[model samples]
Target: MHSTMERWSGRVAVVTGASAGIGAAIAHELVKKGLKVVGLARRVEKVEELSSSLKSEKGKMYAVKCDVTKESHVTLAFKWVKENLGGVDILVNNAGVAIDSSLIDGSTEDLKKMLDLNILALSVCTKEALKSMKERGVDDGHIININSVAGHIPPQDYFCMYAATKHAITILTEGLRRELVARDSNIRVTSISPGLVKTDLPPKVVLQVSPYLNPEDIAGSVVYVLDTPPHVQIHELTILPVRQRL
Candidate 1:
């Protein structure tokens, strides 16, 4: 194992949307590095299965059923982390959904759901994570937000609302970095904008795109940002497959 893998020995990490896809990949990577991981998702059974599959006893894994949009559930999940896993040193805000439809034809309810889950839930999770970091006196903690290339530039069409939420996340991560710096907190905030990751977005939207990147590729980028030195901050990173135009 590399030195970076050893660096995570005995640390605590909380990953939202960790039942499958990129979130699960990140949790797996963290465990490989010897960090205890708390997996939060709405699907209790799936998360439990993932947690149980981990091979290391030195690193623990816990699955917490949580609907990120609900403040009560999020609060409860974080509280459990504090009590059970010591305290969170790394928080990955990766729970998000996409509702793809032309703006004129998009259902208002779909847009609302996207905003609530993608933007609002991310904000709520970051807030709770910061509180835990402060309480633990854990200077030099990390916050990683999984943004998208759509956030950097507008999409062709039908992706307006989904892109909007990502744009908000990009802005949120930037603003959060400033706030932590002003408070003289050692918290590092980073946003990773991935281009066309191969996850189950709606089939209709997936059909419109070209080849996609793997979720683990995005996860690797995330680990890179998180493993950086305490004094350095990587504000924004964009990762895309070589053939990808966007």
Candidate 2:
């Protein structure tokens, strides 16, 4: 039997950095699939615009102003979800950045920003989401981390620290899975790694290749993963442009 999103209809989902690019696309797709979505981003107006545009979709969208690098912001965001939406059944940790710095000669501030947003922020969001899931007995809750192909490969010039942070995500995803298994919880954790997506996150000067993947492509992968059977778990999924040699 094929998997379907019927089980997740009307459920609540928290998507970080949902203002634009991959996060926006994922939020849009999830709303259309009938899941009530809360979009968290620093650019609150952008998310509000998206929510407004998606007014007639099968589900609803709420905009929350958030800077994921701040733990307090993430905490408040989840608290709001708990109070207003009961709890979150899904969390897409898509807030990430690729700095214009290198490991060898990178500014400490730049490296810290990458680490704080990509790794620390994701961990905190997972912790909050898991707490919400546990409190409400949501065994089928899913945590989808928006990772990058750089996580699985060596650093490439300017992406040195960014790659290091993504590598942390790869390990963190597995670590969370192990902890869930130890507790015998049915909650699922997934990492979706895409290569060279056409997004503002990556610097344009470094994109010297043709045929980059689009934000919608990653969004489609997220939908596919979420629609899988309850018995299925897609731990790691890597997507790349067909002709691009990584």
Candidate 3:
């Protein structure tokens, strides 16, 4: 099970929501693997701190302040990448939120927030990445969506809308794959779904599942999918903790 990661050294990757949690972890791992990483987060300072800490690593990490919900910001961020570092070869749509609300009586604002960031933002980023790849003739580019088990099945009453947004990701991932195949493109799309992880996204009152996954665990999954043979496409990869019922 050797990784062809050596081929990616010095290539560019853009990771969204990289200030903390899974995004930050993935950025760290990619940097260690010698890929130039651009970490996009509203809290750009945190990513800067991470960049400083990883200065001695094999690769490098660049921080950009980006609010994924804003389409203009996303557009300019990719533009900056093109001017500064050529273009992006990999994109990780990891910025997402889950508000504790119900569909039956949920605040419309909360639902919209989830929809905008989780679904619309991911789509926008994917479009930008695919455009960059196409312009640069990067047929081997990859797009990874950091999805969840909730997207597969609503685990709790409060997470119904968030789950709905995730389900949209599942569909979007396959849809992109099909589109790429139709074009005879080597670009790959994958959805990495995790059951439970100790992250700040979940509310404090939410039950803490024991033996839960770590942000690094999901990061490892990202590396796994990216390391596969160029001909092998991993359409969906679901990761869960041991004894995780939901």
Candidate 4:
């Protein structure tokens, strides 16, 4: 089992929204594979508990309190990662929120909140990660952006703002990939767009929706992307439960 983790023995990874659900699972998976992981989330206590439960010789875990929407918090967190565990080699931009309401009925503030956290924070974190990677001379770094099927095919009713934010993330991921490639950078940018995953969203939403993908299933896709060789870049991967319609 340990030998299987050799590929990631010396790598450093950072996962945002990592206190619970998919973010936490991704951090656990990476640490199991021998990558030192820094879990960033607003729920510091939860992330601390998560970090304490990991078991790996070559890999370690750290918990940082971060509200991704805040630029100063992100900056401080990244700086801490650099000072403590070395520079980041992989960054998982997974912090997000869901605000469901019809376009006309939605509060402007709510819409802005979704956009700020989902789209703006992702950009901030990516920029910071890229800067650190470049400065550290990590020629082959990976950035995994967790998007949603909502990004590609939006629902007919409700979730207008949430879906729009996701769409923006999709576009950003693609554009960043192009930019990195044009610059001849070895860094890889990938977007993992998943259908409704089983998470702690309001029960009403899940009850209305048919089948949802498991969080681990999405995490598996992330691990797969990271495990791929440097020569191959998986630009976009959309995953849905078999029973999902669109």
lDDT of 4 by residue, 1-246 (tens): 112335667688999999988998898888777788999999989888888888544477889999999999999999999999778889999999987766887788888888899999999999999999989888788899999888888565688788888899889998998898798899999999998778775356674767877778887898888777767788899998888876
Give one digit per residue, the lDDT tens place, for model 3 in 1-246: 767878889999999999999999999999999999999999999999999999999999999999999999999999999999999999999999989898789899999999999999999999999999999999999999999988788558678889899999999999999999999999999999998788998655544535578899999999999999888888899998898776
- Misplaced by over 4 Å in model 4 are 1-5, 56-58, 202-209
Question: CA lDDT of 171 in candidate 2?
Answer: 98
Per-residue CA lDDT of model 2 for 1-246, tens digit only, reads 576788899999999999999999999999999999999999999999999999999999999999999999999999999999999999999999888796678799999999999999999999999999999988999999999999999877788889999999999999999999999999999999998899897667746646689999999999999999987999999998988766
Models ranked on lDDT: 3, 2, 4, 1
Candidate 2 Cα outliers beyond 4 Å, as residue runs: 206-208
Listed per model in order, the count of residue pairs whose N, CA or C atoms clash below 3 Å is: 0, 0, 0, 0
Per-residue lDDT of model 1, residues 1-246, tens digit only: 132445667898899999988999888888877788999999978888877888655677789999999999999999999888778888999999987777887789998999999999999999999999999898878999999998989676688989999999989999999999899988889999988877777474664677778888988887788777677788999987778775
Worst 10 residues of 1 by lDDT: 1-10
Full-model lDDT for every candidate: 0.86, 0.93, 0.93, 0.86
Q: What does the lDDT read for residue 1 in candidate 2?
A: 57
The candidate, 2 or 4, that scores higher on lDDT is 2
Off by over 4 Å in 1: 1-5, 202-209
TM-scores for the candidates? 0.94, 0.97, 0.97, 0.94
Report the Cα lDDT for residue 52, model 4: 84
List RMSD in Å for every model shown: 2.0, 1.1, 1.1, 2.3
